[model samples]
Target chain A: MPSSSSVPFDYSADGFAVRDDVTSIHRVSWEKIARAGSHWTGPQRVEIARQARAARAARNDPPWSRDALPGAEGRLPETAVEAARTIGADAHRIDRAWAESMIEALGDAAYVELGSIVVTVSALDAFGEALGRGHEPLPDAIEDGTPDGARLDAATDIGAYIPMADPFPGPNVGRALSLVPEANTLFFSNVMAMYGGPSGSFFDLKWDGPLSRPQAELLAARVSALNECFY
Target chain B: MPAGEQIVGFGEAVVRGSEDLPAAREALRQALGEAGFLEACGIAGIFNGLVRNADFSGIPLDDAALHSSEDFRDKLGLNDFSGAKNSDLSRADASQAGEGLFPHKGQ
Candidate 1:
């Protein structure tokens, strides 16, 4: 039950910490999610991320399909590949039924792990593309041991596919990633750095940055609208 | 807010996986310089993931956020969004939008 304020800007748990020099918060977050998960190995997680990137790239291509790219033949589980692609390319379509089946097939932890990986990679790649820089190279996989398999709190139905832990009085985005603490922390650290540095200056509409706070909020709101995200 | 409007178009292009994203990027760069354009994209990219995570988790809006954002959300018709409805947590039919992934019973 660590309060949101207690999670340091450079927080790392269970042998997972991003390098401080990685000033690019997205890259830092990318490194964290690319690491091994509770069920998937680092390589497996990386592969899933790769597939998610490919899925996002292929989104504008004709004949929409959620298929993994050709090179990923048998490199990861089919369900895992599908989950990554779906979460990356069309996450708004993920209803409870889709999630329940994914959990039933992949186990709750793995499913959560896969969704986290997909969204992280998708976000990074999207940033790269928007910046007119190609996707960042996947960091070398760190061979961490098996996932610690720690479910810190009993999940209750939160109208999502899987039950969620108790709500913290923070942004729903943070709560969204709480089921897996590593993912939650990794994602938020990157967000905090990218948006406001250590000060969490997200709501300061006139703050200094390459883009003004209003400009940043504009981009954020538009993306959220496009994704149909309510929180 | 013309710049913001252009950014909305650029952000939508990036989020929707549009082929015109390069053009959109160029437009934003022209208006906001290279650094500003890059920052705009970076913010949009971060939200792409954040929004998805929130939608998937179905976490409700914080009471403060909901209260403060009521006017804006209403004006934007954000409440009409499927994800917004799902976040209510009290709606019995919230989870019934689509069929559950499991087809067979008790496999």
Candidate 2:
């Protein structure tokens, strides 16, 4: 058996240093998204992250049969709250019409940011849930920082709902999260570390790991199916 | 195809959280042992987030990806998914609609 010290995990790519306080991969990744992103304020980001968790918790509750549910008060914007609930409970329902409506209400940038928060929180929470550890608390929001608004990549319209930044030989997940670079960085960094490194070696038919690539792919495919995700 | 039954059952249990989870987990444990079984759960948890990211964003497969995965997607009936069917909206439309909503001040 390998000791804890022998395990390889790095977060330098996302500007995080190894720390004794940051024990789990999920906790550190949660800290990354708690910061202000390209569109939302830090407080707003944190609030949305909270709502994402709340939505996940409420997922198994009886469906709000009526069009309006009482006591839906939240710190995040109404549209953002709805987006979080939809994403957490059932992302498959996020069709073009719903996305368009959200963009109209929340603006393209904010909508993108909300989507980023939902995915980030869901990933972390799901990991914790699978391990029976539950969710880690949200870190303090980094206030007084403005969005960098960096659009360095010349994205191409590749039949997606949004333009995709060039990923070259990389998977569609990179391009999918490219609209918000900070989100992309946080998500991919965690994914790369947990699954395998960025070399894409883990995605092949045969690979060196405790789990074969086919077995890994099968788990991925099954989860995607359960989520009703076609990508 | 060697361990298809156990693998598929394990995957389903991981996603569904069904009552069969313990049995499925044990089957996978018997096949891949502890580390591999745990890794499978981790991968499943990862996709639980990843699939949402793609679906919520309405991201479509690039041309090459679309072409290559056609057979696999069809065989798996993935094309019938709601996200795939609803992903026809153009990015140009979204961008044009959001014009002036967020000033690209930093650009």
What lDDT tens digits, residue by residue, belong to model 2 across residues A1-231? Answer: 112332222223222332222235556666666676788878788888777777766655555742333333555778888887787777877787888888788866577677778887787666545544445567678887887765436766665566667544555666676766776776666566456422343233235556667767777777788877887
Best by DockQ: 1
Candidate 2 lDDT over B1-107, as tens digits, reads 55567778876765665768778767876887656665665676677778888888787654445554645676788778888764442322322332232122234
**Residue A167 displacement (Å), model 2:** 6.4
User: In model 2, where do residues sit more than 4 Å from their true spots?
Assistant: A1-24, A60-74, A142-144, A151-153, A197-206, B1-3, B72-75, B86-107
Q: In candidate 2 chain B, what residue range of length 10 has the lowest lDDT sum?
A: B94-103
Residue-wise C-alpha lDDT for candidate 1, range A1-231, written one tens digit per residue? 111332332223322232343245655665665577666787888888888777767765542553446556776888887788777766766676777787888877677777778777777677656665556667667776676676547766665566566644444455566677676666666565556533445433235666666677778888888877777
Worst 10 residues of 2 chain A by lDDT: A1-10
**How displaced is residue A5 in candidate 2, in Å?**
18
Q: Identify the CAPRI category of the predicted complex in candidate 1.
A: acceptable
